[model samples]
Target: MSHSSPASSASAAPASIACTSLDYVWPDGTTVFDGLQVSFGPGRSGLVGVNGSGKSTLLKLIAGELRPSGGTVRVTGEIGYLPQNVTLDTALRVEDVLGIAGTRAALHAIEAGDVREEHFAAVGDDWDVEERATAALAGLGLGHVGLDRTTGELSGGESVLLRLAALLMRRPDILLLDEPTNNLDLYARRRLYAAVEAWNGVMVVVSHDRELLERVDQIADLRGGEVAWYGGGFSAYEEALAVEQEAAERMVRVAESDLRKQKRELSDAHVKLARRKRYGQKMWDNKREPKVVMGERKRQAQVSAGKHRIMHEEKLAEARERLDKAAEAVRDDDEIRVDLPHTAVPPGRSVLTLRELRLRHGARVDGEFELRGPERIALVGRNGAGKTTLLRTLAGELDAVSGTADVHVPLRFLPQRLDLLDDELTVVGNVARFAPEATPNEIRARLARFLFRGARAGQRAGTLSGGERFRATLAALMLAEPAPQLLLLDEPTNNLDLASVRQLTTALESYEGALIVASHDLRFLESVGVTRWLRLDGGLRDTTAEEVRAEMAGEG
Candidate 1:
């Protein structure tokens, strides 16, 4: 890939992007990047960072979706951009999104004996636009979707894949995707993974999806207003980061020790100077020495003390600054730490049961389905397979089309939309709404564990970012009035940062309750200790994560 020679290689590549002295600031006066110099050459690069790290903003700038506050972005070839939040008009057809609607309409018109010059112009030389569009859609696991299907007919995951297919049909030289797999199911994500793997042109993806990042040729870590390049994928990046963090920590310790030593030396110098002054004063007061001799001695002592004091003070200041720099190098990866003993369920207690369950979105449980004990279940399926419908039914937020979904324990559901929290209230007030009996102090103490401490807990829910809102909603659900013994989380990891996902995993570690979370996040499912894998396709069936991965890879 010649990452070392980005200048030469990127210039020659048909698809490339270069950002020179780039700067961006939000409308609210929050600075994201300043004088950021970055370039992308041929081959895939995974752009990763913490939430609000400007990865997406950089992509937008490159794609010309946004104008940089300062600096310039240069790009070669046509760009295909799939933003993090995709909004398509539901009234549009598949061909419209794939940008072949005009050509298709023109072809059909000519076939109907209206051989107009306008039709010929619209068709151009692309008589096979329909074929190409179909192939693109099929390549992304949308083969079953017809060209006439409305955008409203597709699920969220399908829509994302459709957008990708649209981009592919354009045959753009450069592709920029921001969190492309946010709502994708395991199967849909596999299609994305394959697409990313097959990308030969320049591609820069901003994603937290582990599997997707693993497919990239390189990793560009955006941090502290600059980008650092790693030669390999996510695993290699992690290893490199671990090594760097370890060294940074060591440097911090050394700097701290040096600062302490300097402080002590400064203190000791003060004490010694004071002692000398006392002795000199005694000599002067008692008239034990000649006046001229005493005066000269005192002057010498004052000069020497002043020099020593200044030297010691300067050394201390330098040490403190060094210590601060060293500390800055160390990353702050705070995790959620909480215990939910009240949510614990006994070993053999029944949590939830479904009988002949038929969801509104075309999913059905074949027979009596029972979840007993503190079972951690991963509900896997394709989009529109009724995962949300099932979760909502169990939470009593929606009634089943026809069947019984009984919840024997006090349960709480974290919906995919995260619409449970009131926008007007603060995080404290939101959680307080769920735990009405709990005092404000008690609620604040619990919220602190979710990384909402002090004034942060008072931040309004509406003002919270995607990651913060996820945590706040989670906190509310986990700390509800009765304390959910059975939890229903629908894509809980969606739009969450890596740290927030880890926080969720940590929080789940302390939870001793039954859990049925419908998510396609393979790493997340593994991390949270999924006890069972239930594939809710035509009917509920037991499956394994490996099996699903194999199926997605076309191996099964």
Candidate 2:
């Protein structure tokens, strides 16, 4: 259940956050925000936009990580921020990590005399600290884990929950979370959504999770450098967008009609004037009765000038009207399209064969593993358990120190870090670089299909947001002339919003190739139809789906 605060109370005025005429410009002369004005208040709010739409950048501005180039961004109360993906050092234990904040709060409360001396004595300083830490962890479903367990030893899902626990301990008035559920497992993601649903404070969440958005009070769509605040959740926002797009389309049609009419009228007037001129020239060349012919020619010329002026004015007015309508239509609805080439690959009976394969980092070793073709597999383990290393070896990016690796078919890999991208190039340029055979126009067209259009296509890869870079890389891989028969992905959902991840999932579901992915996102794994799992501890072992679900439950 959600908690009620004074802001939500009947007598209190609704709390509001506002950005007034904000403008943000990068060092490279790119303008992300221009005269942008947005207001949000108590309850959950979603920030939605395509990749490179400055969603994360705007979140940072609100968090004070950046200052607006021209206007102001102001918030009424304390702000709590959760970044998209972050790694905590393994040296710090969960309790010690949470203690850093609890200790400070305890000291502040004591300094302020919030508790009496006797009360303090009854609850030992260290005891109270541990109690508070435990409560925080429990709230986030991490209470069962040993307090001394190193943060770095946690899995991707565990780390996300812990970070949220830490954020919650602060109890800020406004929470600014950027893709809070990016790396969470299915159960963890649901829990995170519950946490957001339970929050009473004002929250501006930058995420692509449709389910999460469904729980929000409002959705703020960031598009074309502006923010549109919808009164309801995702469904309502989508309905509204559809209505707006329809209206824009109607305006475009009207504009086109007016333009055609204007052109036709202009053409007719030109034809009439040319005919009169030709007649006058013929009379002059024939040297017919001078006075009568000259007088008639003069009269025709005067009439033609008058007609021309009237037609010019009408045409200009029509053109201006069409331009105005076109402008309105353009402003109301402009979307980037991503047209990924679907390459055809010959069906192969056996794509990959792993027979008693073992993997490990330098000195650490794991057990025997086996895999086959046309199978959907998931690799699950803690952070440093060599999940990525295993994928690398399977993809032939790395050589296994001991186990034999065998593959009978062509393969493609999408790494967690997007190592395939060149940071210096634009989104389109990067695609062209990877698929050098594609024409420049084809590359641009394809990039647009991925939602990198207009100036965004020109954005440097290093400067593109994490989501943008991922999309660009994925677009490049999928657009290859002959798609790989076996696809290997390591943490594919790392930086994507829930929506993008789902879209990608839909695409993968239709893929004909075999897939072996290493991810902490259980939802993504489930969405992609992972039939079997390879759990890597000291070694690899095949386990039932129920067993993996049990492990997740146990971790929680």
Candidate 3:
């Protein structure tokens, strides 16, 4: 269903994209990148890095959304950029969002025989703009959607696709997509993946989606304000990274050994020099030779001792430099370490119950579910299917439309927005608010495991990066009073990078409780060892990961 774009044609030479001596500094005095240089040729390049490593910032700079402090981004052709979070006016018609309202209106006027010079000018060369727009929507699996429909009528995932359709209509030679599949459902993700696969232009995508990354021609790993190029897709990139890390670690070990050996040699040199000085002084006091001969011997000995000391010092300095260089190659991404023995539920216990549940939004979900022990349930459904509504109802944040949802155990719900945290409070203060009984020392100790040590724990939550905020929120929930025995998470990996996702997974691994997670990430759902899968359409139905994948594959 995809419409052919002008930029999709292959040529003898590839398009050029380069940024030289890029420098960016935030208003809050935080520097993201300094003197960074990178170039991307025509092909799919998957940009990846840990959270807060300036992946989004770099995209913005290239797209002209943000200006670099000092540098130039050169692109040989037209560029189309899709930001991470797209917010369209709810009242705006789909045509307006697609940037073709003027052209469509002109065409309509001409068809009505009111053809003015301005209308003709507006219609210019895009006589088939409406058809192109329709095709673009249909290509993304939104075939039923029309141009006159308002944005509010579409689901969150649908809105994302609509924005992407607008970008595609431009047919830019270079495309910049920033976390395009963050909140997309399985069907929408597959549609997006298909579009990526068909893209023949230069495409730079910043995402943690494994499936999407696997489609890329190369991976540009952004770390320590530098880019490391790896040929092929994410899997190949990971293999290369593993080899590099192994070599780096070996160099570190060798450097450490050399440093230790140099230190010992320097110490021995100093001791020998001291002994020679003492012996020389004793010989001089005894006057074993003439004064002139003794003076000559003393000068020679002093010169020899000085040279010996200088050589050992120089070797020690070189060893220290080698150690520092070796250490720079190793990455030390933090991991959450938690022991939640108190949150354990007995195997026979009933954790939750849902009886004829209906959400306020008119979605009737009737089910009877009982959780025993630490059963992990994965909630899968399309956008606006009432997954978040159900989680909120279970957390007592909202009232069920008709039936009741009773929680037999202490529960905590982590919404996608992460608004539960008080922005005014520090990380330690927020956790303390949840657990007032815990002492300051105890809270600090717990926060340390969440990778907020000392001053970082005392900083305001609003100042933390996306990954840090997630860790802080997770810490608050896990360390809350009564120890949450039933944990609810909604799209936990929506905004997290791959490393942060792994960290969150590690945190959940130690959590001994019944868990319910609403997510569109199939890989993540599988990674969490989900015990059950529930699809929320009109009602809940038992499903499997394979079925979900098969269903998406069929739709695609």
What is the overall TM-score of model 1 with all chains considered together? 0.89
Q: Report the error of model 1 at residue 543, Å.
A: 2.2
Q: Residue 205: error of model 2 in Å? A: 0.8
List TM-score per model, in order: 0.89, 0.74, 0.89
User: Candidate 3's residue-wise lDDT over 1-556, tens digit each?
Assistant: 1111224333334666788888888765678888899998889999999877898888888887877888777666677998876778999999998999999999999999997899999999999999999999999988889999999877667888999999998887889998899778888888999999999999999998989999999999998899989999999999999999999999999999999999999999999999999999999999999999999999999999999999999999999999999999988876566555467888888998788888876666665666678899999988767787788888999998798788998888888767778989999999998889999999999899877897778878876766677778888887787878999998889778887777678667777789999999987888888999999887888898888888767742
Residue range 1-556, candidate 1, lDDT tens digits: 0111123454355777888888888664657878899999899999988765777778878887778888888877678999877778999998889988888999999999998899999999999888888889889899999999999888878899999999998877889999899889867788889899998989999888888888999999998889899988999999999999999999999999999999999999999999999999999999998999999999999999999999999999999999899988889966666555467789989888889988876778978999999999999888878788788888898888898988898888888878899999989999988989889998998889878998889888876756677788888877777778888899888777788788778878778999898988877889999999998887989999899778767687
Q: List the residue pairs that clash in candidate 3.
A: none
Per-residue lDDT, model 2, residue 323, is 68
At residue 355, candidate 2 shows an lDDT of: 52
Which one wins by TM-score: 1 or 2? 1
64-119: candidate 2 lDDT, tens digit per residue: 78878877776666677787666788788786656554454565577678786654
Who is ahead in lDDT, 2 or 3? Answer: 3
lDDT of 2 at 536: 68
Model 2: pairs clashing at backbone N, Cα or C within 3 Å: 208-499, 337-448, 337-449, 338-449, 338-450, 339-449, 366-538, 366-539, 367-539
User: Once model 2 is optimally superposed onto the true structure by TM-score, how far is the C-alpha of residue 288 displaced, in angstroms?
Assistant: 11
